[model samples]
Target: MTATQDSVSSLQTSVPPALSLGVVALSVADLGRSLDYYRQVIGLEVLEQDTHRVVLGAGGEPLLDLHGQPGAATSVAAHTGLYHLAILLPGRADLGRFAAHLIREQLPVQGASDHHVSEAIYLEDPDGHGIEVYADRSPESWAWQGGQVKMDTRAADIGSIVASAGQDTAWRGVPAGTVMGHVHLKVADLAASRAFYEELLGLDVVADFSAHGALFVSQGGYHHHFGLNVWQSRGGQPAQVGEARLLSASVFLPEAELAALRARLLEAGHPLPATGDTFTVTDPSGNLLRFGRKV
Candidate 1:
């Protein structure tokens, strides 16, 4: 059974309810190369670009911003950073189109699988950040029991998933309520992970399974916003360069609330990084984090 629990008395939703998360930025070894891979190869439009960063989008808004930081190195087993940035697609058809595109372009896929709850396509961004591009199977269809969300990893009918995307003449972006959704991480200790993301981050727990080596939590009512798994770090300490380095994770808050959080972080000694008008910060595990008004 899940161990994490939602501590919020009630979820405070903002006006219009900010879409899950608009953009997740990552620090990469080669900004130019990654930009080319995402834009030219991945086919995402370039919304904005600068010497230090580049934002790419599927349609209306930017989904990912790639930042070039020379010294940002990551080791595969690093338990201190981002787990994965999930991109919720418009539908199965969109997934189809992307699959076809990957086949046509010779794009490399790390792995693809059906998580019972959702079908996911995964790949690593140039800087070693985990990226999951997926489509949901309608909320009403999701299976759950005993307050535990049932998720499974099984073979995906790629042919069927791809067929959906190939249906429409053009790709419709991610669904209306889609988001960066949940971020999963490898934490040193279950208790400490709970202390920060739940008590401190203030997100409600949706699932907590100490037995399954995972924990899931969310804000408002849209599944989990973050997940923590101790399978890799069941008894390890916070070390450096574990294969994966969570470049940065984002949380969207109202503009005013974001300002408040900035002050809160400073007061807590987790100073936000100032870049032009953006203020970013690093979490206890050295993972970079960004916050801004919900977009």
Candidate 2:
């Protein structure tokens, strides 16, 4: 709650142990096509695969384990599923290389914008799930005021951003230790999303703008890691099982703090829908947020 040189990082009074992030999975409509796109265009190395799924990694660590199935490809305008899976590049030259790669592979970006704290290239995956290719500006450079995280989006000069992606090399896949930086959501309602992620889940509200139908928050200030947008889904519900399902998600926390949060949420009448070494609560929007000891 206090800020020194590093203000955006939310130092919780009773933080649970640090269970840093784990891998994220996407259930794409066509496993082969999705895998091909990620592996070839995005430059991720495939770890393992069979008839049903494929696991992938960048720098040798798994980032996503994709489940392939035959399902209806819904309209991006109406799908109540993933907002985007953000892939954090090590630097900007890598981002440029990625931009080059996107251009090479004929990958179409929905839009690319610079959010003062970072620059991002946005695209939709094979099954309508959103994807963001981005890299952050240093933490020391992030700005804050009035109990809100400040962010602005403008045209990121494609040439400048690509030049920064990697000073020497092109950003094909993330460097080793790449993680699911953060998961953004396109929920139906902002207030409900805020209540569940902030109030019920106890995440500090880093930023909330009523006009934008958007919010930006993170445990540590890493430039608005998790994003929520409701432009199309003004009041949509979570997607059903047949079309798609969110296999799982996580909240990296210190192991020391799990029991306390679990007890706190239980006392608040929002006990875990499922619990183990970790506790999980489904948001009003049906996305699962996992809290557990930091791995």
Candidate 2 Cα misplacement greater than 4 A, ranges: 1-19, 165-172, 271-275
Error of 2 at 288 (Å): 2.0
Task: Give the number of the best model, judged by lDDT.
Answer: 2
RMSD, one per candidate, in order:
5.3, 3.0
Give the number of the best model, judged by TM-score: 2
Model 1, 1-295: lDDT tens digits are 2222232223443222343555776667677888877765456777788998788776547777777766666645535456677888766776777777777668888889997768888887676677788877775555545445567778888888777754453433243444465677767667767766666565555577767877786665455667787776665545354232455666777666666656666777775665333577654555555666664
Q: Can you give the lDDT of residue 272 in candidate 1? A: 60
How far residue 4's Cα lies from its native spot in candidate 2, in Å, is 7.4
**What is the RMSD of candidate 1?**
5.3
Model 1: ten consecutive residues of lowest lDDT: 1-10
